[model samples]
Target chain A: MKHSHKKWVTLVFALSIVLMLGACKKKVAPPPPPPPPPPAAPTASLTANPSTIQKGQSTTLTWETQNATDVSIDGIGSVQPNGSQSVSPADSTTYHLVAKGAGGNQEATARVTVTQPPPPPPPQPTASEEDLFNQNVKDIYFDYDKYDVRADQQAALQADAAFLKQHPNTKVTIEGHCDERGSTEYNLALGDNRANAVKNALVQDGIAADSIKTISYGKEKPFCTEHNEQCWQQNRRAHFVYQK
Target chain B: MKRLLSVVISVFVFSVILCAQQDWIRTGTGLGVEKVRVAVPDFKLNNATPQNTALQKTFDDTLFYDLEHAGIFDMVSKSFMPTQVPGMPSDVNLAQWSSPPPSAAMLAFGNLGATGNNLAVQGWLYDLKNTANPQVLGKQYTDAATPEGARSIAHKFADEIIFRLGGGISGIAETKIVFVSSRSGHKEIWQMDYDGANQHQLTHLGSYALSPRISPDGSRVAFSGMTKNGWEILMYSQDLGRLVHFPHFGGTNLSPAWSPDGTHLAFSSSRTGDPEIYVTDSDGTGLKRLTSFAGPDVAPVWNPKTGGQIAWAERSQVTHLPQICIMGADGTNQQHVTDEGFAVSPSWSPNGQFLAFSWMRRFGPGEPGAQDIYVMDITTHTWAQLTHGEGRNDFPSWSPDSRHLVFQSSRSGQEEIWTMLADGTQQQQLTTSGSNYEPNWSWK
Candidate 1:
């Protein structure tokens, strides 16, 4: 009976030792460990102060990064992880910042809207009217003691008529002038003839008769006082004065 | 019976001789044949009172100036006269005046006396050459004891002597000259003595008043004035001392001249859009258009002698230069008196034989010529330049006697009224204070 009891005890002890060995192997071969937490991806943020500005003005760009080894801006070279920079852009732009780490690269973008300034005011209507008239109209010069419009002055008369036709609402005064050589009375009559001749021509050219008035200054008012041909030629003219 | 017959024949013959002598004097003086050499010495102070001394000086100065301006006498200078002055016919030595030094054919002497505010002057004119019957004229005048009174006496005495010696034409010492003066800050009508004394403003229109024409009766002045409408003929009555209502012809009306009979007025008007000559009655009725040319006709003057013709400046359409033209009073027989050059401002002489005008012989730019006064004979159409190239001379008007001309000249650097003999001698400036122009002598 003592030999049978010792065999049972040995079998139970061997079963227990086998169970402990299985447990130790299980501990040694645990599932391949998680891959080191993905290296903690780098976090980046970018911002711009006073992004909208005039063409000649400037703005500052600010950026920040976490867990990054190198930081770079789209237009700027690599810089510190957290920094600020001054930049002037001629047009609307996007500022892109890149943060690089072991795991991956992160990018941040900032939009700066650029707008143009307003234009200046314009000049008065009356002043611009006079300016336009002076620019377009031309004087008709005459020969000494002559009332007829010469051939060379035909172009000036035609141009004047064209302008007058374009501005149908405008009225004009045609002043006939003469050089200081003839008697006051004679020159007065001559000036009258010159002014009337111009008026008749203008009427024939389709300009309204009532829109034009004539005056004879004779030699009383001369454009130039010098006693030379150049000056006399300037004095003997049919000058046009624009009226509202 | 024979003795009675001889007496009657002698009387008739004597009367005929007297009439012949009077006819010779008129013919000789009428032709302005020769200037009568006259000697005028300082008037004697009959009573050596202070009043007499002052009055005598005024009388002497006025008398001398009047005779010098008469244009019919050659006055002997005071330096050439003998020291012995004649107070009356009894104190005169005719031979001394007719001698070599004076060479005077006539002598005028006067004496002045003042009693309280009353003054008296006794004057005598002697024919020095006819010493046997030396007394030719004798006159006595009494007036107030003031300078004006003394001047009046002198003027009367001078006119008497001038009438006796200077043909039948009346002396102009008492006549006035109407002109345009800017002294009152505007071109206004002004009147002065023929010798430029007593200058005064006639119109206060406060605007431009030019080319004054006094009436023949010396009662009104016609001028061109700028009104709200335009330039119009304005009449100023000397009797009323203010402007009178005159008709306003539409457009510009200028240069008015009255007829010799004081019945009509001639002027230039632009009523028809072209300046033309127009004549209207003195009462602004019977308006008549005299010219109808395309060019301008201006400065119309009437013939003072017969009032039968009108002269004006017409701008020729062909030449474009003003030419002197004349026409009958009824607008007939329109003829051009000036053929060439720029002729303007025509003035008819009193005798109706000549038309004086301003002519620019050479006109146009760069042509160096001057405006001068020229007298043209109407019958022959011949012209004589009265003023040489001495500045610009224009607007000549004949004196009443037709022996002198008053014109505007720029010889003194400023336009001033100047008087000269009709033959262009004895040029004298009459205005000096301010610029004066367009002088018109009174008809009387």
Candidate 2:
């Protein structure tokens, strides 16, 4: 009986070895075809038509993609897989297309170089006479209770006279204003003297006498309305108004 | 005792004679005279119809105010008067009014009656102290029963009393004041009664019209108007109720003054390149330049009494300040009336004795001074400041009576027309709506 049991044991061991070898073979079978080759990475391309443009001009951007479920440009949000769009950018810009799919994300870029047009031509020199007078002519100021032209205002008078001489046909009305410190009657007379002083100066500087007229405001119409030295100084001036 | 009684009687008789011969109550110039205490009682409604009752109140109120504004009377308050109002001389109780409470020297009482639409007023003024010869004046008036009619009667009665007691100077109650008003959105010429009643626009020039001077006969008003051509002296005829033709003098022409005879007008013109005094006939003919100076000469006024002298504001050559100056009508005998300070707007008194003007005694920046009204004796050159340091007072015009003056003042926070006695007492504002200036009293 002992002999027969040993032989049976050897047979069981042999069968166990065979089963283990079979399991190893099953583990070594082909690795399931390598996952179907990952469906081919997404491809994208973007291009801008008429890439160079002047300011205020428009340009078209065309893009195409393959194997992409979602596609978008940098500035344009989510868009169809392939399309074209018109854009008017104030400055130069680059367009980038992003294609996202199950395989991977692919990015492509296009630069639209915007070239600026030339600047406009210079403006015409046909300014109005009044505008010219305002820009060139200046007001002269006087001291308190004084009608004579001050030393500081000599240059202003000279400039005014020079401008008037240049435009001999232009007529001007010189208005004399006074600070509200003296009596109305006295101020009227003082303003008159001031206007006459200016007129006399202009006439002596070779300007036509008839081209100038004078009036006295006598603190009636003030350029500034404050009880201060600065404001009063501004008010005490001989202003020029262009006449037709 | 008999001899003493005879001496007392003779002395009383002599005093009465002296009083009569000297005209004791007649104060010649209405200045420095003792104010007469006068009582004005409510006029009785003779025929108590609605119209009569209303007219009575109007007449009584008008009479009281007219006397009070005369500047020559001391008004007795109604509270001090006797309860039994006197409607006529027959009803007056001399002793009661002359007693301590009222102490009235004169009594003005009247009665008003309305028949249909007509009103009759019987007014009388009596010397309360002279019971024997109490009647001083009695007047009767008949007009349509209206407030204006009642006021007119009252004014007439008051003038009668003023004529007798105010040294023969006619009352100014009937005079009108012409001034410049900006109420209508433009500076236009306006006229009002002496007491600020009946305010009406005299010119609808639409442009600025200033410094109106009425003629002596009240027929024409001459003013500086901003016409299309420039500042021109324009005339408005009251008789025609429209603007009349006045030749335009070139440049700015302003402040026209009429001669006392109403035959000539003196104004300031800049036709010769400097504002100078110019004179022309009433018809704008006979134009003659009266002054030619380096500085401006403006605001001319004539001596109302003589019409031979003209006073104006002339700027000093050295100081550039305006000084009051007087010259003959023909532009001779020029004299400076003011020495220092800024002086302008000189108005000659009707009596030719004084010149009223506006002066800034110490005028300069940062100086503590104000424009005040001053009256100077023409003969002596002694001046008295009429307006105190109230706001700025200017443009003084004398009343026809020479006892009152109308001027423009800024004391009420705005420029307004005000009236006061010649001595600057009883300063009352006459205008309150808008800024009014350059009040000119009409010459009667």
Candidate 3:
């Protein structure tokens, strides 16, 4: 019995010593684990949600960075390392983000495309009498600020005059338009002159004067939405509408 | 919703109060007249409600802006005013208002509130230098609690203050600027408050409407609209909200101008081969030819005060530059107001002493001249250029008080309506959206 007890005590003492040695080794450390691999250089990535949209629509931009101290996106200024934002682009645009850290700067890009909305459906032939009149009668163009009939527009006016003569029962209203320029009042007068010039041409062409009317729209009605000379020229014209 | 409304109301009122205490500098001391230095304190609230708070803010803002644009006063900034906004006669501390930083000579303070459906405001103007007789003027205005009523209340009070302090000339606070806007995808006549608020599209012709001239009585607008019949002078009644009939002469009629008494309209018509000025009753009868010029004659403006003369633009030949000309209301005594350059759109001053016209000096090919507004003394035939090389400025219309003019300019890239003092000072742009043109000040 005394020998058995001595063996058990010796085994217990050995096990405690071994455990203590293992703890001491851990406390002392084992070469510092190679300094954590020197902290990898900063890398940034950005992505746009629903990367395509109709024109004027908005999209969400999200970014994430690895080991970055600062992050910034092109055209968007500084932002958090991990965050998201909403952006609206009138056209296809590319967004870039940079992540800066002690090691170096890294960048990534995301793109969003904005497409134009589809054009409206074509008007039906039987939509209305006014639509029919507008579609059939070609409009005449005018010079800026001057109301007199241009030499080139006479053929279109002659065609309109002949149409008015054929459709004696249908009264016609000549609409005057001007490009967006000059004073509003002056444009009104100019538009009047243009419309009158057309009516006078029609009257001289053997169309009954009573079948025609004129109104001035002075720079108010624009066929083209662009601001360039091409658009302005298209806006300055005389359009015809038929009235029962 | 209630909390949001209250917060918005409070912030708006506070900001408006803060804005009134801005720089009190006056630029139009051209004639060596000392500007009236005045301080407008934030109106004290007599009673508090969410709706009233919002209305009070609008009223205070409108009043402050009106006073600032008077062109005769040096407005003291609110930052310099004393912390206490004394609203009434007995509550005011004269020394605080008359003190250093602002050194205001006059004080305009009032108490305003909206309760239920009604709004009331009491405004007082005080002469700070005169301690014994400190009160310069006092006015009370009441109306509905709506935004329009609040604005009207502010305008009436401001006008009263101006009448009492601005050398006997009336204020244009209650005026409306009738102009054309193309924002609706088409040209339409629009009306706005004198300070460019509450913009409303008056005509929805869907076609183009132009040259909207409000009658002296504010009952109708005589404009030219395109109809199937041709460019006939169409009249739009303000009260009827529809087109009214005008005698059609089977040709182009445009640029309708109203006489002072609202009895007759003078317009340019092409019924007689060339555009010529003509006069007719307001109902479109009793037509009489006013100008028999061989070339184009257009844009006739009546002298509302004189009632016996009209000014128009006349060209001796179609190719010649148009010149400003005046003739008797009876179509006699024709005289040219301008001798040189391409001048048009002549507007007569309310007092019948001056004619403001758009002129392009050195108007020819390769000349570096620009269109500018010029005011002429009818008696002396002497003129002074009010604008110089600031884009193309034209369509000079006079304020009812004769102290200011509204004109159209392309200086800001797009044609925008602008206002300036009679001596060409304090130029301010009034419209910023879309393109605005031909601003006509309403008759008081």
Give the number of the best model, judged by lDDT. Answer: 2
Instruction: Sort all candidates by TM-score, best to worst.
Output: 2, 1, 3
What C-alpha lDDT, on a 0 to 100 scale, does residue B118 get in candidate 3?
A: 84
lDDT tens readout by residue for model 1, B1-444: 323322332343345345643211111022324578999899999889777888999999999999988877889999999998989787887778899799999899979899888899999999987868988889999999998899889998998998888755677788889999988888799999888888999999886787799999999999888676656889999999999999988755778999999999998876655668899999778999999877668888999988999999887776777889999988999989876778888888887767889988777657666899987767766566679989888889988877788999989987899998876888999998787878999998
Which candidate leads in TM-score?
Answer: 2
Fnat per candidate: 0.17, 0.26, 0.19
Tell me the TM-score of each prediction against the true structure: 0.72, 0.77, 0.67
Q: Is candidate 1 or candidate 3 better by DockQ?
A: 1
What candidate 1 gets wrong by more than 4 Å, as runs, is: A1-145, A150-182, A200-244, B1-32, B46-54, B114-119, B143-146, B205-207, B362-367
Please report the candidate that would top DockQ against the real structure: 2
> The CA-based lDDT of model 1 is what?
0.82
Each candidate's clash count: 0, 0, 15
DockQ, per model, reads 0.14, 0.21, 0.13
Q: Find the 10 residues in a row with the least total lDDT in model 3 chain B.
A: B22-31
